[model samples]
Target: MRIGINLLNLSQDRFGGVEQYITNLIGHMADSGENLTLFLFLKRKLKNVFPQHEKIKTIRFRKVMDSADVYDAIKKCKLDLWFCPLHRSYLPSVPVPTVATIHDVLHTEYPDFVPGGLEENNRYYGQYTASFDAVITVSDFSKSTIARQLSIPEKKIHVIPLNAPAIFDQAPAKITMKGVKQKYQLPDSYAIYPSSYNPHKNHLNLLKAILILREKYNTTIPLVLTGYADKSNGVYQSVLQFIRERSLEKQVWVLGYVPPEEMPSLYWNSSFLVFPSLYEGFGIPLVEAFKTKTPIVCSNKGSIPEITDHAALYFNPENPKEIALKMMELLNPLTRKQLSEKSSLRSRHFSWKKTASETLKVFRSVTRN
Candidate 1:
């Protein structure tokens, strides 16, 4: 079957979660030999990142996302089906069937965390999702959330889980870790939290938990944060202020946005992964930590328990004391080692191949209907 993918959402910031999802999914789909011809739709000047294959072709548009050029380019492709991986419908009404992936309805669920408020979210989903023949979501939780938020039938939403990026499966060499540590000037012992400074990410609670670990429990290990930080956000400024007021200059290290090349070593060298997010469709970091044989201490909210199972230690994300206590438990070498072993086994449950095959089924089903 021939499929046209809306790739105009991808940007140079390849480290963005959704961009990584698109890149890895396309790569695995290309290698899987599913007898599928893919036409990638992107802006004209952007370099094509996917591999060149007889079955895969790049279609360039003058403008991307909600543009006449995007609709014209996609309509010209004349594919059997169209898939928009970025969760919204960017193209105009087309002759072929349409399937779009809605990662989550975070804006509707937590309106305060998102800008433009509920009215903006209503218009966003109303315009983008109304024409799709079918919808795809990352987890069962997200499927339900999107169904309620969009007032769409639950049966129309297909729940297909995402796998960790391919890089997480391989461990870095000890020398590579040492080099990375020296280059970043990272602390010798630290727990890594690789997420942006979004309000819903609940960074404030994580920082408070780290402080409690230091003062009350006397755990001197620093917390390493790696994600993009914009100074304009009040949350970002408040985080820095909290660090200063608490005298945690040495105990909290914020290394803004590590590249894809260095993420494995960063995960490999960390003691464990701490993801105290208040909400997530699916925590990709949980799978990454499991792949790296790094134990996780994350929130019990959303899909965390569903994804991690017994491989992680759970805590209420809002309670900093509970987060600290659970984190403290993982500090034990033997316990961490056992959890890490279990993590490798659990990581086997997810893979790019499985994700692609299941996604292909959805695409095929949409065409059949």
Candidate 2:
């Protein structure tokens, strides 16, 4: 079977989780040992992003290429099925059956977090999801949200949980804590929150929690933040402003956009993972923490509870006091040890290979119809 993957929406290191999902899914699919030919439709600049695989064919187009041009190229492939890993549909129509991975319905659920608000989100996400033959999402929460918010049938949406990047499995062995600490100027021990500075990520609340920990409990907990910290982004600017206003420069270290290979070291050396995001389709960082046996204190909202289950100590993301309390609880060595063991057991439940197998089944089923 020939399957075309629409990856034009991605750029190297730009989209944190979405990019990881697409690249890892493709890598596993290529190595799945299935008799399948994969056609990748991506920008010319991303030619070297994906590894050279015998079963994969690259169809590169310039970044300036319009929808019509992209459609024309996809049509030429004569594929049995087309998969759009990212949420939105890039093409109006395709010759073959189409499947799209809608990671979340965050835009509609939390309009304030989105840039142009409801109307803009509806324009991009509302109309196009139903056009696909099948929809894939990261969690049951996301699947239900997509179904209800977009008016798509629940039966049409498949919930496939995501795994941590394959790098984490081997990263600890390769990375040195001393080197990673020196390179990033990280404190001896700190909670790591690996997420971009999006408004919905609730970075402000996390920082506020840090301040509360210091002022109320007189306990100083160092925090190391990783992900894209674009200076132009208002959320990022606001986080910096909060850190400065509260005199949290010493307690908080913002390490923007750490390399993927080095992430495991950060987790390995950290006291615990602190995820204060108000929303997530499926919190990938939680899984990463699970894989690394790193204890986690995260928001109870969204797919977090669904994903972490018994592996994490939960807190209300909107409440700085609750978040601070959870952080204090995680500092207990006994609590951390128990959660770490649970995390190891939970990590066994997810893998990229399983994700690839199930995804391939969806492709075959769609094409066969």
Candidate 3:
């Protein structure tokens, strides 16, 4: 079968979980003896994970301005199915079968955090997905969220959990770790929280918890924040102000965006991983922590509990005291060792090969119908 992968919405600057999802899925499918074609923006660079295969073809465009362009492209390719891994597609209609992955309905769930609010969300998740033959989600909780919010049948959504990037599964070489530490000027011992500065990410609460850890609990482990920090956003500005007003400049290190190759070393060298987000689709970082055997302290909200499955300590994200208490609780050597073992075991349950296999099943089912 000829399968077409649409990557029109991929941004040049931002390479987050969604980009990883598409790359892993396509890379695995390319090796699965299936005919595949990728339709991406003209100057965007895909990672080295993609292998050369005779079955794989790529078509590039400067930009897709409207549905007619996408529709015409697919018609010319004569593909049996089209897949939009980014939850939305430009085409209003397709000649053959089509599937889209709905990562989350966070826009409608937390309208305040989203840029365009509910109206734009309505177009993306509602109208765009309604045109597809099938929809895929990262977790059961997300599947239900999309089904209920978009008014689609539960059976129409496929739940496929995301795995950590392959690098997370391997131990970084000692020399590489040392270089990464020196290159980024990382702390000797610190907790890492890898996420963007979004309101729903709850960086403010994490900052509050850090203050309590330092002042109330006498904990000295600093925080290492790594992700794309949007200086344009007020939330990012607020976090900076909070750090300054509380005199936390020395206690917190905001390492804007780290390269993918440096992540495993960063996670391995950290004391632990802390994720205090108010909501998430699948919590990919939780799995990354599991793979690296990094003990975790995260919120008991959204799909976090569903994904972690008792592998890590949980706290109420809104309560800074609770977050601080969990942070202290995991500081014990015995507790950290035990939880890290459980995390390693839990990490075994997810893999990119399995994700690709399950996705292919959905594609066959959709096209056959």
lDDT, candidate 3, 1-369, per-residue tens? 778787766665767888889878887877776655544423235444345666667666655555576677787888888887875554666778888888888887898788788888776665566677888899988988888888878888899989998888789999999999898787888899998778899999999998988889888668999888678877789888998999999989888889999999989988899999999999889999999999999999989999999999999999998999999887798999998999999999999999998999999898772
* Deviation from native of the Cα of residue 162 in model 1, angstroms: 1.2
Model 1: residues with Cα > 4 Å off, grouped in runs: 64-66, 128-130
Q: What's the lDDT for all of these models?
A: 0.83, 0.86, 0.84
TM-score of each: 0.94, 0.96, 0.94
Q: After superposition, how far is residue 113 of candidate 1 from its true place, in Å?
A: 1.1
lDDT of 3 at 291: 93
lDDT of 2 by residue, 166-272 (tens): 98776465448678888988888889998988889999898889888899999999999888876898989998899898888888898888887788899999989
Which lDDT value does model 3 have at 13? 76
